[model samples]
Target: MKINNLKNLFKNNFVKNIFFVSSGTAIAQIIGTITYPIITRYYTPDEFGVFVTYSSIIAILSIISSLKYEFAIPIAESEEKAVNIVFLCVGILIIYSSIIFLALLLYSNEIFSLLGNEHLNQYWYLIPIGVSFIGIYSLFMYWSFRKKEYLAISKTTISQSFFGNISKIGFGFLNMGAFGLIFGDILGKSAGITVLSKSFINNKCFSKANLSEIIEQSKRYIKFPIYSAPSKLLNTLGVQLPVIFITLLYGSSVAGFFGLSHTIVSIPMSLIGTSVGNVFYGEAASIGRKNPKKIKELSNNLLKKLIAIGIIPLITLILFGPILFKFVFGSNWYQAGIYAQIIAFLVFFRFMFTPITNIFSVFERQKEELYLDSFRLVLVLIAFGISKYVNLDSFWAIGLYSLAMCIVYFVTYIYAQKILNDEIKKI
Candidate 1:
């Protein structure tokens, strides 16, 4: 009886989207999870580790590659103008990312020397190309959100995961190793881009807003990308910084394990935390103009629900992480499993409060997020330094590293809670 009632409640729009988003993410997760085993069979842990490190760097570098335009798309005036804004942002990104890539090519030798990773030298060739693809793909996803095309949004991701990981499997079978993983990822983006290009051409959003209006509104809007973009990017970097440090201090294999664990943990996060937050952004962005009190009400409820959803999985993982890791991911990724468990636990704090902090964006608090993000960056450096000196293992490094980020989330959540309350009072 209770189970049936719970199911009924989730049928509501708010809950329904969460479930649907998570379901799609689950499908993607399964594809990626299956690929890991084949990848393990073919690549040495060391090789996998190098790829992992490069991937993390790529993830962080992605922030620079994209120039933080995705966040801008949703807040634009209308669907049509949003399309124009996105294309403009993409144009800016192309110019900058191309320059960076060429510079990287010219300075590749110096970079490898400074970074001190011989394996990384091989991956450097892909970085420039990866940046452009990542930037384009990001805009495509954001465009999906701007148009409220959730089904298309979900399908794109599911397809990307399926084809990308499948490519990895074939590559591993052919002894392509980590390069296969990189190629698989690139191919998935390329595939997604083709799909996006077709949809974009047909979509009438391009007819809605003119370039001048977009430029005007960009200057006028509360959620300008200049600040919001870097904050969002830093948030991603803060999470992945551990992999960078571990790669430098210990090696890429440890980096691989860290990346592997972080990727798995991020599944639930992307499915639940990110999905709901994205919806909330769309819902709450205009609440300040209409009814700010409603934003408070929604955020409070979301925090409660997010906490409830996070707790059981975290506790379960903590108790059985080692067993699950060994059983599920092959022997090579026991470390990955353990890291996932720790990260899951750490994520409890993060997931518990992300929704509330996200409300700040509705109120134009990107600067506040930047301040908190700055603190997180410092803590990341400290955590990395300590781990390097004390020689912590990969899983623990992953855990301790994320612990600092949790602090930022909690702080932001508290302030956002207060800000929403004040807005309610004003109303």
Candidate 2:
């Protein structure tokens, strides 16, 4: 009877969406995991450093690509209004992509030089293209979530992962270097866009959203652009700081190891946490507005789920990360395994915190999120600063960085709980 009840609970729409999203993510990640051995064998760590550098640059810039107006799509009160928000986000993204292109044209060389990867200059032109694809995908994804089109989203995720990893391996064998990785990323996104466009972009929805509607919707969610966007940007920089600083301080080889470790850890996050978060965001927003008490209960349930699911994998990584990395990615990547061990705890915190972080949006606490992100940014910078000033080795420096971030993530979880409890009291 208990098992049946649990199975029934998992059949709820929120859980169903999570299941579909995770299933697709699992397939995608499996493909990536299988291909990684071949891809890593074909490409050197130094080359991966260049790829990571290029990716980090775009990752930071892409946060502001739509000024974050895309975040409002699912939260909008009505489908028509949400449709307008999508168009509004797309318009802003176009402008942002153009601005990035011009800036890159003017300073791509200097920027790559500063990041300690001048070799990335040849691929700089791809940044705008990559940004546009990612930005548009984010916007479209929110709209899909609003419509509860989980199957479509799942299909696109699988398509992207399948095509993207395959291309990277193919290009690697061809000796295309970092461009292979970059091109593969771009191609994967293209596949996603093509799938989503066919799935959701129709004349009826597009026609309902006009210039005036777009402008009005943008104003309605202006807080997203003003506060949420910068917070998101800072959060992204914090996440990518190791990639940037490792490259600058310890050189690209160390950065490569760190980047690969991060990529491996992020697979779980992308597959499970991100999928659940998207579904949770949609459901939480709706429930929080009607019966606010349900929000608290739902959050608690999710917290339990995240922690319960994450604990074992995290422990396994901390214990045998080096052995696993060597066995899977060859002896050359053993350093990546070590890096993974140091950061494994932090990844656990991240896995739990990321999905629930959307609770900030549910409670209209974007400002608090901004403050937390700012503090996180300071902590990351201090970690790098202390390492540089004290002449610490790469391993110790990374340890310090991971420790600080783990502390920050714990505080975030506490803060989120408090926010949820307080909101429950008010209701």
Candidate 3:
């Protein structure tokens, strides 16, 4: 009877959305994990380092190409302009990456020297090669979210994963090295875009997204790209700082361990937390605007769910990380167990905090969200610096970093709850 009641309780849109988003990505990540062993067997740490570097550069470029507008698109008032903003972001990314490509061509050696690795210098060519299509897919994704098309969202993710696995294995066998991963990344995104493009672009929603509307919409959130560009750049740098520190202090080998362990451990977050957070953002925004009274209720409900559902993955990682890494990804990845546990405990804090952070967008608390993220930025910097100077192991540094973040999350939740209460009292 109790189990039946619990099932009935999750019948609402929010619960269904969470299930839809999470199940698809969770399955996709599992497939991605399965493919890891295949590639890891063929690639050396140094070769894998190339994959890591190029992937990171592509990630950074995607962010730059995005101009952070995707994050802000939901907040825009005009749906038409929001539609155009998607393409606008795409146009800007292509233009920006093209310029970057030209410059890299002119100063390949100088750029490689800047990265401290000549090998990584050539991968810059892959930037324009794949980023254009991938960038388009990213912007279109925001459009899907803004339109509340969760099922389409789920389908795209599944197709991307399926194609990604096929292309990765096929290309990896061709002796293409890191290019295989790059191809997998680009082709996956391109496939997703192609699948979803017709529905999104042809919808009545975007019909209103003509040039005049684009200008007005662009004007509305120009500050986003401006402040957000460098903010996101710094934030990405902050994320990768540990990897950079690992390389500087310990060399490419340890950095490989760091990257691999980070990836393996971050699975729960990348799969579950991100999937849930994606839906939560759109859901919170919808409720805040239409059903203002439900904000706290939804927020608290999400916190409980995150804790409950999140624990299963955490236990799996803590228990099976070493064995799985050793057998599947080879003995070298055994250290993944230790790092996975540390990262999971850290991600646990993140999982709890994610829904609350989304509430910031709920009540139009963008500034407050920015402030909290800034606080988090500071904590990440301090932790990274200490780890670097004191020469802490990757385990210790990551744990410290996660601990600082957990503290910030709890404090922010307390404060946001209080403010929410005060606002409700006046009602």
- What local lDDT does model 1 show for residue 272? 60
Candidate 1 lDDT by residue in tens digits, 54-144: 6766777777554565676776666666676776767777787777778777887787666646666767768767777878877877776
Which candidate has the top score in TM-score? Answer: 2
Which candidate model has the greater TM-score, 1 or 3? 1
RMSD to true structure for each model, in Å:
2.9, 1.5, 2.9
**Top-down TM-score ranking:** 2, 1, 3
* Cα lDDT of model 3 by residue, 153-218, tens digit: 787888887787678778878877766766776777677786556666577655555777667766
lDDT of candidate 2 over 1-427, digit per residue (tens): 9999989978887888788888888888888889888889988899899888888888999989988888888788888888888878888889989998998899988988988888888887899999999998888887787777888888888998888889999999899998998999888876777656664556467778788888888888888878899999999999887788999998888988988998897787647788888888888876756566776677778889999989988989889999999999999999999999988887888888778778888777889999999999999999999999999999999999999888888888788888877876776
Residue runs of model 3 more than 4 Å from their true location after superposition:
1-11, 204-207, 226-230, 408-427
TM-score of 1: 0.89
Backbone clash pairs for candidate 2 read none
Ranking of all predicted structures according to lDDT, beginning with the best and ending with the worst = 2, 1, 3
TM-score of each: 0.89, 0.97, 0.88
Q: Which numbered prediction scores highest in lDDT against the true structure?
A: 2
lDDT of 2 at 35: 85
Which segments of candidate 1 are over 4 A away from where they belong?
A: 1-11, 64-66, 194-199, 204-211, 221-223, 286-288, 389-396
Higher-lDDT candidate of 1 and 2: 2
lDDT score of residue 111 within candidate 2: 85
